[model samples]
Target: MAYFDQMGCKKRKRGERVFKFKTFGEQGHPVEFKGSFRQNVKSLLAFGNLGNSLCGGLASWSFQLEVHRNPPEHILLFVVEEPIEVSLNRHCKHCLHVGWGNHMICNKKYHFLVSSKETVATCFGYYEGNCNESYSGTAGKFNLVEFQGHVMHGVFHSNGFGHLLCINGVEMGSDLAGYQIMEFWDRLCTGLQARKVSLTDNSRKRSMDLRLLYGVAYSEPWFGRWGYKFGRGSFGVTQQMYRKAIQAIQNIPLCLLAQQFGNSSHDIPSMFSRYQTLSGHFLITLRDLLRFMLELKACLPSENGSIDTYHSGVLVDTTCRWSPKRVEMATRVIVEALKKAEFRWVSRQEVRDAARAYIGDTGLLDFVLKSLGNHVVGNYLVHRCLNPVTKVLEYCLEDISNGFFPSQEGSVTNDSELRTRYKITRAQLLKDMFCLYSHFLQEQKSMMNTGIFATTSLASRVILNSKYLIKEYCGKLPSLIQVGLGENSDVYCTIRVSHDGEVDEGRRKVIVPHECFMLRNNTTFNELMLEAEKSFKEIYFGLRNFSIKSIANLNAEGTDLVFKVVKVGGELVFEGSAGENGLNDEDVLEGFRRDSVVDCPCGAKYDDGERMVSCDVCEVWQHTWCVGIPDAAEIPSIYVCGRCEKDILEFPSLP
Candidate 1:
């Protein structure tokens, strides 16, 4: 993942904002203001909810700023210069009392309070005589004014259901932003519930990155990355459009499904519940996946196939009630029974495909998904996303909250009102986490690798793969799980699996058997390879235990499901045994859609490099083997295809 490529950690200036917004408007009509920051203060206030919201936090701190003469260059500047040391809760007249001050060696590490005023929260730090140097400014020089580190203020106190640790606000300097914020949330959040944890976040940042000074591959609004939400921010958004955005935000795609039929009720929380996998979502070469499979001596995966690892002696069948919780034991054995592997993504589809291939039952997969919020990635478009929701889960792997309360010692304001205020509800926290995930996806779309195949406006939902949690939550497996493409989904994909031979040097003596397989769902180039590998054995390309080559392309432009497809039980079934309760499946591929015309006029897509001959006349590349060239033939420097030869004969002056 090129996550860090566009990230910048340049220390922030003394009074700079966390981020800078491009415009206040949506897609077409950007709300650009020609007036000064002071002149537009009132206008900015009208955008978000007052007191505790997006730019409202800044506005509340600097409200009536247009009242003051020459209100400095920006809002934060005036906020820093003439501070308002008052808390958002007016009744708590003394919100900034010395609650408790414990001193440490270099800095005052552990001790602080919450302020609804984010600028005030930002000013909560005070390094005594032995502390390192802090930022400089007239107001900043006032040990009371300029505190650079992070300041997260909660409101949980003795009376009136106060100090519920509702996380009023947090202010962080640029130098210690992203990771530090993660640490803060980890300390405050309680824990998980049924392989699910909830947490909310709203990015108050608006970093002013001058394009003239630096070159970003791409950039978007702060919300477009972290709080990449659907509603409220857009201009003239009707309920219909909002609902549409909501529904599209769920299927993990932006399809125009009717509200009555769509997953309209699903939101970030829904996305969270459906998050399943825990492996690295990093994309690797198909050659790499094949290499990994070969190293493990793994057999090809089939939807109706039983789990069998011959080298590992792991045999898992799914018949007779999935054979009495036998899968539960096997699932543990492969993942945690022997050794709990590092948190890694586990593909739900991979497990389901093999289960369906083995037992010819979709119940197992349905049972697993039901436990994980029943999220379905509707179109091939969303399948391209890296499952942003899972990314949030991966980043915050540690148990942050203990159910409804914060994990940090001083986070709780009142144990009594914790349920009402501090309680991290599944609904709210899930919303925040989901927004963060959406933001992550948008950032990825703007990154260097994305094209129409990704970054499409239709993308909003990032469906998670949660096979890791299937057994944990899918208690008492159901008897006959029927799974298929959802309601009226007639779309089908045809994957053209041309052999990838780079991994097979002169060491192998075989031209990989030619074949094509229809893709079941949104798949990647690597998975196309995996299917080809299965076809190799499915067709008995070579003798058992003899290494065979098979890897190819989906023929479509491209789309990557950024999931770590965890292998089920590797090949334990032998020559003809399909294992207990397994179907003796023959190699068959169902195709859909006409193949798009690309590469050689012979209609073959690009093949292994050494086997392709570039036409010198038309300057178009062609598969040498497809153009009457021998498999063992070398490319001729001046070779021209038949079409080019005819064209040259018909018109001598043709360039």
Candidate 2:
């Protein structure tokens, strides 16, 4: 108190200082300091009724000097009579360890700060998807603490920073600074022994996923600027240019460039030579280098002529020297491109042709492409001189005015043509995939309505049943059916023939090959057998009479599933049961029929009566007046008893 007051500590108010100290004498007798107090004594209440640890060992004790001052003050002295004992429950004791301290499940640590003064207990535990654990073969140190039973109940964390500290299952002291937290802890354990409380690293408290940006391998300012605008803008020419640059290296379209530029250089074949020179290396023809230099000059549109034009510039270290300017950086990138080109040579004429192709495709000229041919000598000199370090790409452009890329080389190297072809191919493929995926999802949804769970494999059947996915096999079928010239041009039928037998008896399936389109379109059972003879000699030879009917289930044991294949109204369909293979329950196929224009039972060509009604039994349209029911509302829901009523009743009972 004296030290702080003498050293520029402002006097907030005037008050007397009181000290209450507890000490242990020689015989371990507790000695309390007698204090002069004329004020009333207030009794303190304990926190909770929870039992204390019976095996409680000596845990901790602390002594802190607290100061109090007020205006027109009266000095008062008060001391807590019953100190909070550091008690551990059975579970907490079991959770304690010697080196790493108390832990929860999976070797995770739980640190607790129990305050007797505030009557609050805070326990800090590790949460999943938090900080990555260090793998040093050692566990983290934590304090064994208890509130009611287990410390897992009142766990809470700040959503913003994931600052996890549980106070009775709620968060407390989260907004408090590290020093303030330490002071609060000290007040809570005044009688406890003093031990230094080490603060955990702030990185561990963060909820943000920052691992992707943990290193400093890239330059700060450039990376920051680029990262800020990484995926913000629209899909534009910049993306196309970047794509071209990548593709040039990946697809190696330089052969096309060599062919286009071959006429510009003498001994063009020699320019592409990979033969080692006299100095134990392949000699890069100076003329070939000149041709590439001219091509870059003709294609790239670098805005600046020299480094002197740059007001704000970066010092770029080339192999030969250090230079500063956006223009120089642009040249350095071109040099990198040439090195990657791997001795593939192109002529100046080829460069111009490539530029034309690029201008036609993108419909605009980039900075580098604009700069090319604008200042040929300047570009030539820069390309010849510029050589950069490996990490030159790490630098970012502070301003876009610095330069443009000679991306016209992309067109020259056949990159643009290839890209267009790829896009068309990709678009068609994408449309097909969308159709297939949509079909699968629709099938799944349909099956779900029928209380059937459609798995991934079953959903794929929708694609299999379609003609498009299996076009390679299905496309040739129509031609084979039309010609019937080839030996294998036949329709194959897999018929599962069932028989009356025991429950364990399986159905027998036979594959019968018939002549193409024989069982389709207006062909009767007798005609099918006669046509089947052309394909199957043994089964169909001289076969005459046969019976064909739609298969239906009537709890019969020996019912054979028959499918009548037909081309009804131009679509190949099976006129049979809805539950047939590859057909949905809703797909109940019907045969093609001709509707006869017959007069109604009322003896009219068309029903024109106002109160018209139709007989439900015979589907005969009749005037309500003729049926003795003049009102349309008087038409019974179960309309019957018309002229064909007796016949309708006996039709179902017919043998």
All models, RMSD in angstroms: 33.6, 34.6
Which residues of candidate 2, in runs, are more than 4 Å off? 1-84, 87-207, 211-321, 326-330, 333-655
Task: Give lDDT tens digits, candidate 2, residues 1-655.
Answer: 2222332123213342322211211111121111101000110111111211211221222122233243121111112121112222211111111111111111012132323222222211221122254422112232224333221111101000011132221223232333333333332222111111111111211221111111111111111221211111011113233233222222323243344335654333322321110011111332222223223233333433211111111222364232334443443343334334443433333333444542332212233323332122111211211125432111111111112212223211224443332222223323422332242222346534332224322322322211100001111122213322333122332122222211112211111211133233334544433333322222221111212222222221222211233222122211121122322111111110123122344344332213455666556555565567755457878676455777766676656
Work out the TM-score per prediction: 0.19, 0.16
Tens-place lDDT digits, model 1, residues 357-454: 43444664454333222111110000112357664211101221232111323221223332233323334333433353333223344442244325
TM-score of 1: 0.19
Judged by lDDT, which candidate is best? 1
Segments of candidate 1 deviating more than 4 angstroms: 1-127, 130-140, 143-231, 234-242, 252-455, 458-655
- The superposed Cα distance between candidate 2 and the true structure at residue 418, in angstroms, equals 22
Best-fitting candidate, measured by TM-score? 1
